[model samples]
Target: MRKVLLPTIIFIATILLVIRLFYLQVIDDTLKLKSDNNAIKINYDYPERGYIYDRNGNLLVANQPSYDIMVIPKDVKEIDTSEFCTLLKITKEDFLKKIAKAKVYSPRLPSVFLSQLNKKEYAAFQEIERKFAGFYIQKRSLRDYQVPCGANVFGFITQVNDKIISKNKYYNSGDLIGRQGVEESYEEILRGIKGVKYIQKDKYNREIGSYKEGRFDTIAVQGKDINLTLDAELQKYGEELMINKRGGIVAIEPKTGEILALVTAPSYDPAILVGRQRSKNYTMLYHDSIAKPLYDRGLLAQYPPGSPFKILTGLVALQVKAIDENTSIICNHGFSFAPGRFMRCHCHGGVIQLHRGIYESCNTFFSTSYMRTLDKFSDPSVGVDVWSKHLKTFGLGEFMGYDLPTGRKGNIPTSKTYNKVYKGWRWSSKTIVSNAIGQGEVLMTPMQLANMMATVANRGFYFTPHIVRKIKGQIIDKKFTTKHKTTINRRYFETMISGLFDVYNFGTAHGLNVDGIDICGKTGTAENFTKVDGKRVQLKDHSIFVAFAPKDNPKIAIAILVENGGFGATIAGPIASLMIEKYIKHKITRKDLETRILAKDLQPEYNRFISKPIRDTLINTKVTIKEKAVVTIKDTSGIKKRTALKP
Candidate 1:
């Protein structure tokens, strides 16, 4: 019985020993496999970014190969720390701090020490690359800007923030993303699908072969090309024309609503945001107080239309049946409601026809007409509300749904808004007489104003303004092709257009008329400024002009604003006229006009150009501190106080 019990105990012990061996070798195999992976895995692959292009098959943005020096705390080998720090031009303290941070970020994963290294830098490192184990270079792509000045339109790509990553699971840390404009709005379309390549690594962190013989690898697909309606020459010309000006110009085709040219003065070259020197250059340009070049004034600036508002009021009157084509309104220089006070007109004709009223921009005619339209309704506010609604349909006080991201919803006071502001139960035309002349609370973007002129040119209907004519190999959205209908009758626009034609022939915009090409236009000098103290400071007026050319079949319609440019007829009108002539004739015949416009020096407020001297002056002012404290600087006698440091 004793011999049998002893044998049973020994058998149980043998079974326990075998179970322990199985647990250690098989059950814990995952941990061993992970440990093996860490030993051989060194390099990481960076997915390529998408490409961008213009409507005419021109490459706008593309990717160029870049390299980043990275460090993996766990995988680093024995090396001369001093020599490595000197080669990288980094301080020993900075190197240690980076390594410590990298450990916290998972010692297996690499962290970037220097990003977007140039060819020279990469070549320097390539000479001694194999010596470093964990501190290897990772290949990537950086965005290259071609047509460099359209920063606001094309926007920029920046590192994805924590907020961005949290918002979208697709984005990872260190990923570049579109920050503004078309880049932001069409991110999905522009950002193509990323591809992955599986690589097999041997021990000691050396790549052995492609995993699965490249079966699991994916070839990177290129991004779709975007086609814009922008005419490169026209846009550049407009920008040059507005060099010293403080406003914007928006030109659009009346038939297609495709923007031909868009310009906002004080714009930065998009090229400044590309490559390794991007952050430094951006900081310098961004903080520039004078130019304020980064601001996108084209779609974002909201200003009173001034006298251009009268054109819409004329259409509104005609739409409401309160005025006819030959309807005459007597103007004794102004419209007077009370005993003495009157809303003044700027030197217009007397007893003018509806067409002549528009041609001469007869303020009294519109004021009386707008008042009559309001008189038709029981509540005066209802009539004004109706007028506001019609204006909204014209793309005023609302977004124009452009291809570019940035846009301001210009203010169009609603009945409810008026009720809240005025605290009144009722309102009348007299209460809102300023709107007749495109003043008071009425405001609109240059693009919106351009579309309004396009609508007038189309005779009561126009296409919605858009920047993209067509994306390469892709169809334009139906919304852009659809026409926007206004309240004004088709017949009314004919007479109004005829009067506008007469304006270029015989009225305010006469100075800018081309003999063969018929141009219809309205000039507006908006009075805006305030006195803070006893001294009467001269606050320059905004020069505004809206026009369409070759009246029979209007090809191009545009709105121009020269902020603080005093007279619209002299400043903004001539610019629009010149653009029309250039677009239609394919050249500017009026050399005299060009010379005068270019040479004419406007006010200080209007002048915001980044002259070469100013740019150089700003760049020279920047102080560069050497990264290495050991590097010595020499100040040579007879040499300008420039400090020369070791590279």
Candidate 2:
């Protein structure tokens, strides 16, 4: 029985091996063609990248014809090197380096010799193409920006680096990929599949005809067109308003959570990164470290939210039942949490209810409410955590999961966050009452604040803010469509919304409103400080504002921050009102506001902080240095990181 079993096993193994060999030889030719690399010349058909359209179907990005000189390093027959170098506008040394690098990449496969050539250059090179053996011009499609703004929104495409090539077998040395913003986040949907074709080559290393009668070839699929939520006209207007400013503006559709416009000041035109000058222009933009034109302040910059944060504080207080709409507190021009110490306020002293507290930006009302909230619980730790839990539900203290790639989840302090800072020191609501007025450890990006406004506009629930409105022939991510409800009751928002509406009527932002629009808004001024020559100096306040229009049925919700722009009503409020008007009415009725804002440039204000020359301040503070000096002082602009101190 053992001898029979062994013989049967051997017989089965032989039969399986014979079937596999037959299938490999007769049926599948894909692996066979790939193995025969020496006889086949492979070419990739790069598809046209997807077109980007605004939500209203306006074209934001389209394709333009361009060319790249591709090289197969081993197939070269030397020609007039000097003439080739002159036509390509590259030095002889650069030619040698490029050829050597191409050879290092692969002698048989194609590599990019010179990329992003314009039509004139392509035509001139094509005239003398027959003279060079290994090089050929490959026709390509490059990004053509239809508008002048949104450089950060539709990020530029560039060649893949070595790291990408090593990880992705689908890409070769010369392939292009998206690097930031919507382009990076939706790369798979925007960059369609590149087709492959294998042609039989002769002994001379010249392509003859299709291998295997083109059975293994695949057709290039043009990238799927996408509709971004941005309104092109609104985006352009926002950029114009922010021309000489140093901050950002973010607006979202309250009902859908679609990002309408995201503007970061000191940005460059997207077209500059399209042709032969891309590398040079990009280097210039990247090196301008002070202005950071390439930096998307709307998505990346995190700053203490200032008075606008009080809106959330009011909501959290209501949810915790620490205060009601009718609850009133008397203000003596400030909040006195401890003896001989107080946090100052700019509001007129009087009896302040929740409505007047928000409109006047009162510090006393919120501080007392915050302390009462913590005292409600047996331990302040449990109380603060509950407060933090409510704020997190509003998309604060975390990334909002927006479609754009670059961002920071602004810090939201929990009890543990303070515990780590205090190191077991005794603490309570009075210890951190500055948080009540939004001047403490509460940091948020412009995007998050905009989302918070959108949440309020929606009454209780909000969809995750997203840049993509639609993708051609495919559904967008499900997460964007899902609703996220807050921990607070829906009815509580009406109480808060009424207070914000009066902010435009009788409060800090009373003078900054558009006629014929019922705008509910909050004005903010976040305290800003920086170090200059080893001394911490207070800079002008950062102006901030958050608002939604038509109060009852909202459309656009916006947040704007103007760094070092002083009070919120001066800069951020006007910009937000103008934006709301532009989006809703489609034209400007307040030419006075438009003219005044357009005429104002905050560059000189920014220059005062960042443009000072280095010198020994101990001797002559304003003198520029021309000679060697002892104890050279450097003026730097940055926040000194620390927990918010109690008054």
- Candidate closest to the true structure, highest TM-score: 2
Report the C-alpha lDDT of model 2 over 611-631, residue by residue, as the tens digit.
Answer: 333211223332121111111
lDDT of 1 by residue, 216-332 (tens): 467656566677777766776777777656678999889999888888875656766777777865665455454445667778888888888888888888888888887887889
Could you report the Cα RMSD, in angstroms, for every candidate shown? 9.9, 6.2
Error of 1 at 437 (Å): 1.0
Against the true structure, candidate 1 has what lDDT?
A: 0.75
Give the C-alpha miss distance for residue 628 in model 1, angstroms. 36
Reference-based TM-score of each model: 0.83, 0.93
Displacement of the residue 169 alpha carbon in candidate 2, Å: 1.6
Q: Evaluate all candidate structures by whole-model CA lDDT and list the values in order.
A: 0.75, 0.86
Q: Evaluate residue 192 in candidate 2 and report its C-alpha lDDT on the 0 to 100 scale.
A: 96
Angstrom error at residue 79, model 2? 2.3
